[model samples]
Target: MKPQKKKYIFHPKVIKNYRGNPDLLRIHLTPEYTKVDFGYVAKDIYINGGWIRIAPETFIENKITKQRYTLVNAENIPIAPMHHYFETKKDWRYFSLIFPPIPQNDCLLNIIEVKNGTPNDFNYYNIELKMADGIELF
Candidate 1:
């Protein structure tokens, strides 16, 4: 019999609201969908030519269902949080970073933290492909 696949959960931390830009990029505890709850403001950085930084803003918990939403969009959408799936490893974990369908130049998605684990230490899992408009997802 084949070994059972281990399922991993993604808990989102930050969501970026591009202010009319639909490239919904997000970072967090798990790798999953980029919802409005995880929305954040884009921060300008002066590194690697230049980049945008997103930070977590608010945490909302459902009173009855106990569901939590990160509050990414100006008009919040009620969604059940989700995470990516990966086979379990002793030390390594898998995640999926999502961005909006639209492309941005020199843009990238990064995993910031792993819940109950180390912080500020990141490993690259996937790379965003470049769009037809000459912009690449980082």
Candidate 2:
């Protein structure tokens, strides 16, 4: 039997074009360019000091084998602001929007839009969390 591939879970609440506009809500996932990959080994997005942080997942070592493995907490899974690429612009080709799993907390995210360009080319789409009343957390 073939090894099962790990499935990535996306949060329902995703803010697209999420740069300083809280009311301008777009569809969570767009098919235009949804196959972009960010080469993240093992990381989780969390709110810290009014900013979204992408860091390595905490893992516990196995006593017998002494091997480190990622802990399966709620944070280990990838949430909203999934992956997307834009084909409209001539110069830019790929970009991504990442969101944390925990939506209830006062979260802040820096939308790092990586544009495929020469030498050094990239853009940032900073997004701040603003939860609506009665919005359920995932």
Candidate 3:
């Protein structure tokens, strides 16, 4: 069996963009860029900081740059499952939210936390993403 990756508290942070670089959230992609894998989390959110315990309509976008990052449900899982993405390992709930390729590489990921039925009831949190030059990821 392969070595198991240690499970730690999942704190959602942009480790890097498509390009293989640290402290930068820039993406270097070709025209065929459909989706980009953010170095935030591969799977299994432990209902902690990165992953919210309560399922809220969350989306990442930069209000300053006015760019909206689309949330793509890559996994065809049920909408009502407590375990949203990875297998139920912890007692807390988990889920995944795949985002399409960011339009601009040098942009901050603004997480827009929204409430059910109440659009006014929402919060915005910036994930301190890199706003430097994007690295080519084609």
Could you say which candidate leads in lDDT?
Answer: 3
The number of clashing residue pairs in each candidate reads 20, 0, 3
lDDT of each: 0.28, 0.27, 0.37
RMSD in order of candidates: 17.4, 15.8, 12.5
Residue-level lDDT of model 2, residues 29-131, one tens digit each, is 2212111122221111222212221223422222333443332222222322332222232212212333322222233333222333222212223333333
TM-score of each: 0.19, 0.23, 0.39
lDDT of 3 by residue, 1-138 (tens): 443222111233553333222121222233323232222232233433222222234456765787666554533323323423433433232233445545433445554435232322223345543434333332
Q: Order of candidates by TM-score, top first?
A: 3, 2, 1
Worst 10 residues of 1 by lDDT: 86-95
Between candidates 1 and 3, the one scoring higher on lDDT is 3
Candidate 2 lDDT = 0.27
> Highest TM-score: which candidate?
3
**Which stretches of candidate 3 lie above 4 Å from their native place?**
1-57, 74-94, 113-124, 131-138
Screening candidate 2 with a backbone cut-off below 3 angstroms (N, C-alpha, C), the clashing residue pairs are: none
Worst 10 residues of 2 by lDDT: 34-43
